[model samples]
Target: MVKWSISILLIMLLNLAVTSLGNVPNFDYHAFYFIHQWLPSYCNQKGTKCCYPPTGRPAADFTIYGLWPYNDGGNSLQNCPGSSYDVAPLKAIQNMLQKDWPSLTCPQIGRKFWLHEWNKHGTCSKSVLDELAYFHAASNMKNKLNIFEALSKARIIPNNQFYQVENIKAAITQATGYRPFIFCNHDAEGNSQIWQVIFCVDKSGTKLVNCSGSPQGQCAYSTVKFPSY
Candidate 1:
């Protein structure tokens, strides 16, 4: 009788394991945001100098904020239950994060920020199922996109001058073949600045795709600043 009960329990556990593996990959989530942040505006808004490595200031460029997973209807999820992240795998890619994805906040060069992001958003992305893949994919995507080069090729240099929102959008759209959604912030001078550029990508984390619904850019001004370092 005990053997029969144990057999039944084993079957149930196997069924559950299969359900989870199928469900996570097949979940109908829509898109990803290659969330690139403009560090100058972020630091200016925070009223602090952007943190850097001992070598000196990291490039005054768009560093990775995150690669967030978004749903079709505009809602998103966070920190999937039982999802945990470890800092060990990240050590292999530590140099890349330090240069391309450095923490711009002060006092210490830390992993807490990355941990927070993974807990908040990375945990929710089925495409990047584990810690190693999660950070590796983000680092790889940063190199793939290279926001600075894309803008530079379009003759859009970050000299703190105001550029028309449409032109900015066009530059990215032309370069990437996907219309990117822009987010803006006002500097201390109350002029609008381009703060972040968000791109929609596929579940595999490789290609740029159309966003089902773009996040609205908050810059009310016709022209927005892309500040210099």
Candidate 2:
């Protein structure tokens, strides 16, 4: 009788293991997108005007958009429960964020943009990185890949003329040895322009990997404009 009970317990444990193997955490993200945007095109998006952060107008380059986490199915995590936006911890890195991740939207009122990013994307990343660590990780990633400089070196100047998006990707791939995802948005004149450049990173938000689980925002063109700011 005892042996039969022991055998039943073993069978139950085996069943549990098999069930657990198929049950992946729905809340978890497999990869992160180190996303940044062309500030000029960002401001040019419909009904938007450039509103520099209190720190002043940022340089003409790709600025940090967000470090978004996504699953294998390309679903991005946002506004995770329990992680609220707080600027208190960001005091130390405020200056750095201002320069690298400044918001071009109006009523900046200090760290509001950062706050939004933290609440939306950073919160979802709490399992992998805390608030300070997440911002630092994004700033570090932005510093590592100078996308603007890479394009310039490749002679794909952003002077409001259309360039083949493939060439743009090639320039980035050649520089970083990994492909990048370029997303587009409509300029005020209804022309699709290169808006966002996304790079894939490992779960820790460090080390560039081949692109995966990153958003391809509204881009269906063979050639797109890299507009002037």
In model 1, what are the clashing residue pairs, if there are any? none
Q: Candidate 2, clashing residue pairs?
A: none
Best of the candidates, lDDT: 2
Worst 10 residues of 1 by lDDT: 23-32
Each model's lDDT comes to: 0.77, 0.86
lDDT of 1 at 201: 75
The clash tally of candidate 2 reads: 0
lDDT of 2: 0.86
In terms of TM-score, the best-performing candidate is: 2
**What would the per-residue lDDT of candidate 2 be over residues 1-229, giving only the tens digit for each residue?**
9999999999999999989988845668878988889989888888886776666778888989999888888778887886788778889998898889988777753488888888888888899899999999999999999999999999998899999999999999899888888899889899988989988888898898875554755478999998987
Give the least accurate 10-residue stretch of model 2, judged by summed lDDT.
Answer: 210-219
Clash tally, candidates in order: 0, 0
Instruction: Write one digit per residue (lDDT tens) for candidate 1, span 1-229.
Output: 9999999999999999998987773334576788888888887774566676665778766888887877777555566655676898888887788887777677545587788888887877754557677777787878887778888888888898888988888887777777877888878777789988888777777778877776655456678888898
TM-score, prediction 1? 0.81
CA shift of 27, model 1, Å: 8.0
